[model samples]
Target: MFLNHSREVLRLLTSLQADLLILEENELLFFNYFFSFLSSVLGLSITIWIWMLNKKQNRRKDRIYKQLSGTNALLIIWVILMIISRFGSILPIVLFGTPGYDNHLNLYEEYWILFVLIPIVVFMQSWFTVRLVYQAGRWIFSTFLLCMLTAFVLQLTTTVSQEKLNLAYHQRFERDYNYIDQEIRIAKEKYGIDYSEQTVEILKKQVTESSVKQVESVKKAFFGDRPVTLDTIILQKIIIRNYKEGGRYYYKRNAIENWRYALPIDILKQLSYFDQNAKETKELLEVLKEMIDLVNTPEIHWQEYQNFTETERRRSLGARYNIPDPLIEQLKKVQTRLLEDDLYSDFFKNLQAIKDRE
Candidate 1:
């Protein structure tokens, strides 16, 4: 049990280390941009389709499907399609996307309903109302209840909550924004940048600054215009340093960092999107493939290489041919330094940048 705990701790630390080295500011900025870019066009298309798709009458094909009256042929297929559509959104998002906070938008994909289940839903409801068909109501209601029970049970283990199976679902609701209002409590905390309309409006109107006595420390470490502190490896700053240290060989680091934050290229820059049809969407997928490539590349283990070459003093850098590599000793240092360079430290540092930008 102790060993299992130790292993989990080691894994989490390793992941944190990896995330620190690789997650770049630009890529995050880019991702936001890409998300926006895709959203605008996709949203417009969805709106248009929804507007056009809406009809007072049941769709012809949906009517056909509803007309078939058999437990085997009708109920089976309708149920199968419903199950597929439910999983298409609820299953995948609940299963994988939730924990990572990935692609919640997929949980809202139009095809899940636009082409299939929604029309079926409309058909079933309409057929019963128009023709007063109440014969299959027993089976339909039973099947629906059974499916809901099954879904609720399965969701317990899914990435999405077995209980709260909604994407736009707020964990809790607050009607008032007042920090001390009777109805509103700040609670312990909230999420990443509150870009909700009200918050964005406020941010758009103000800038906050902190005048630090040891401002020079931050400047040296992460800011440019002077030498970088060991921790402050900015892209433009690093590009200049890369040329000085090992030349273009280190350029890949820039690419990797940039790619990580790039999110989506045109989106990152917030470029013009004159084209967003099927072809453009296809091209976007290809760009995503390239981004995945960059995400997979491992961080360079310069220390490992140095440790390997300790026997050959001439080949190694950093404090001569290097001292004996002690795993226990280095791990202790990692734990100690983690206290110094904690998550809040970096999170606030970039947070300041976002504030500055506003």
Candidate 2:
């Protein structure tokens, strides 16, 4: 009966480890279950193995005492190393609250360390076997339990660290978004940027529109159970950074300028069905893309890159965002014509000139 129980537990551990190895990618469901099972086995086996080894050592005066002393020394070193490595990982989660999915994988990848316990347990049982009074023939049983306990503690630590970090990251995003929205509202009020009643009504209608919902429903119909999160919105910031880094200031500035315009591109598309010019919308997007090549072709300036980085650093430090000097000069030229009642004809003419040259 005892042997059957041990065999069943060993079989279970083997199956879990196999699932872990085959998954190739980290899925939280499998990771949690595998670690839980491994931990329980280690805790049980360690206590039994230690008690049996201590009993055997009591009988033999010379050899058992020397061996036990050596084992104790090795165990102390093993535990100290484990603490140093693990505590270093958990400290950041505790301090900064930036626990991420990556951190979880990093903490638990040290799973192979449990195998070391196997050799230690076998050596203890062997010392007793040589003395010819080995009543407890459960070396395998003890080793498996010891492995489970070690795994349990490590898995627990990782789960706690990851949970802490995820909460922190989510809260940080919400806080920052709320603060930026408030700042925008304050700027709008200070500038006295009031709109007509009809314009305000259109804006309200856009807000109530379900364009995003319709697109998502279409996507879900084709792609089953795909998850989406704030990461999607965060990707736009990454795209903006990429454009700046590549010195595509014309594209980057125009994209940012869109945010300051009458309505967002998506909302404009929805509003287009009601008096919005299709040709103008197409021309705007076309101009945005063409400006990228024009800016890159006219020789990317080092000062523009320097100013872009400086602006980014200041914004991160909570400064008001501003267009860099090089882009500001282009805007000044465009605005000068607008003030002169040129009706942006010069802007289109210059863009045409660049296109003709290309």
lDDT of 1 by residue, 1-358 (tens): 2222332233233222121011134433332332332222222323323433333335665444334322223343356446544644444334332222222233234333433343345334333422332355665565445444543443233221112211112111111112112211211132111224432222111111111111223223332223222112122121121111110122332232211121232221221231333332323333333322222223335655544321122122311212112322332343234235543134223211111000
Write down the worst ten-residue block by lDDT for model 1: 204-213
**Whole-model lDDT, candidate 2?**
0.35
What lDDT does candidate 1 reach at residue 276? 31
Model 1's alpha-carbon lDDT is 0.28
| Weakest lDDT window of 10 consecutive positions for candidate 2 | 15-24
Model 2, span 1-358: residue lDDT tens:
2222332233233222121111223544344544444344434434533544544444565456545544553454456446534543344333212211112334245653544453354345434433343434575456456555655665555442234333443342343334334433543475433434443222211111232232233223323232222222222222222222211124453344322211223322322332223333333333333333323333224556554443234233211122333443453454344335444344444443222112
In candidate 2, position 22 carries an lDDT of: 16
